[model samples]
Target: MKNLFLLLLFVGYSQAASACDCLMTPVRQHIKSTPYLLKGKVIAVLDDKNKEGRDYHLFLRSIGIQDTVSRGYSVKIIVQQDFKGKYKAGKIIEIHSTYSNCDMLFSAGETYILFLHKAQGNLFPTYCSYSNILDGSPASIDLVQAIRTELKSRD
Candidate 1:
């Protein structure tokens, strides 16, 4: 029983670690950019959208970073999932996408990722991973959980 428990723990950790590594580096540093990149620790999770099915924000914290300078590189990451309506806030998940728009403060010319820790007010939940996205993490396909699929821009 002990051995089996340890094995499961190892596998789960290994998967998370790999996921984190996947989104730890900047885009310029890599030769080929993968779709999923960001990975981080979950801080909080909450839905900042109203019933109008218009507003949606997912907040997350950085689990891949060594130290958080200020707000832990908190970002309003965007999710692009066909079945986004199924996901709920506070579900510490991983994201697989590129930084479409950035404040240029933390990530400017880099292709990093953010892990889903918790949901912030409007930002939802996000963790800016300047490294690799967590391995065996939630499908990197969904960028951000949006109530609506059609949109002009995303963070």
Candidate 2:
């Protein structure tokens, strides 16, 4: 399996893929165990501050690589999202998210035109999180609105 994975990495940049699509699967993904994902066009690199206290290096890159093993070419940069860090404008980031942070913090499996880069910290990062609307849910959800609804009072 490891050799197969390495083979996929050898293939340099691939063709363009889904630019915007967030269809999440109910089946849980082993974020830590799976190799880090870094497939996307580094369109724009900027400084982003997540809900977490710390800051991060996020890139407005595109994503699209569902068939890594079959295609023999994966845009992914590292091994598993846990030990990988996405860079924005070429700079490592530090986040302060309070949610699940590791496993449930970052969204996985989707083509985000732009998303925050996640990493654990090192020569490379180790983060595995993707954003996918809950099944039968809208393509996008206003997290702030969700928070307000949860905090709103009932008559």
Candidate 3:
């Protein structure tokens, strides 16, 4: 009976550990399926709570956001380059990210290659995507080159 209990405990732990595990998708396939892909530096991080109130409601309604209220923080990023999307360089854009364990959180002053999806006029990165910090490593350089090559081939 004790051994059986131990086995069940292990099973539950394993499932929880892999709850947010994401399968690696090929770069080309991931790029093709994802909507927005950009490299940017996070300029600021703001608490989403500050956006509450009447003006915020009006803004959300104008933007067609009816029910979804993200309880996470807003990350403002300065667009350094856009690999997939046509976001203009030097422009600052705000993207929302939840505090959930499965989502990638943005930090100020750090650049990242974002694989973003748009929902209700908002952009966010998923943990399963190829979105990663741009730390100027060889692997990052190679990935960026691969993305560039793929984009050129399509052009």
Better of 2 and 3 by lDDT: 3
Decide which is better by lDDT, 1 or 3. 3
Provide the lDDT at 26 for model 3.
89
Model 1 regions lying over 4 Å from their true place: 1-69, 82-115, 119-155
lDDT of 1 at 21: 25
| Candidate 3 error regions (>4 Å) | 1-19, 48-70
Tens digit of per-residue lDDT, candidate 1, span 41-87: 43322222332111221122122222222222233333322122333
Please provide, for model 3 over 55-143, each residue's C-alpha lDDT reduced to its tens digit, 9 standing for 90 to 100: 45435544445525646667899999988776878989988865444656567899999888887888888568788888899989988
Query: Can you give the TM-score per candidate against the true fold?
Result: 0.19, 0.18, 0.72
Ranking by lDDT: 3, 1, 2
Q: Which clashing pairs does model 3 show?
A: none
| Runs in model 2 lying further than 4 Å from the true structure | 1-24, 27-129, 132-137, 142-155
- Give the Cα RMSD of candidate 1: 16.9
lDDT of each: 0.31, 0.29, 0.76
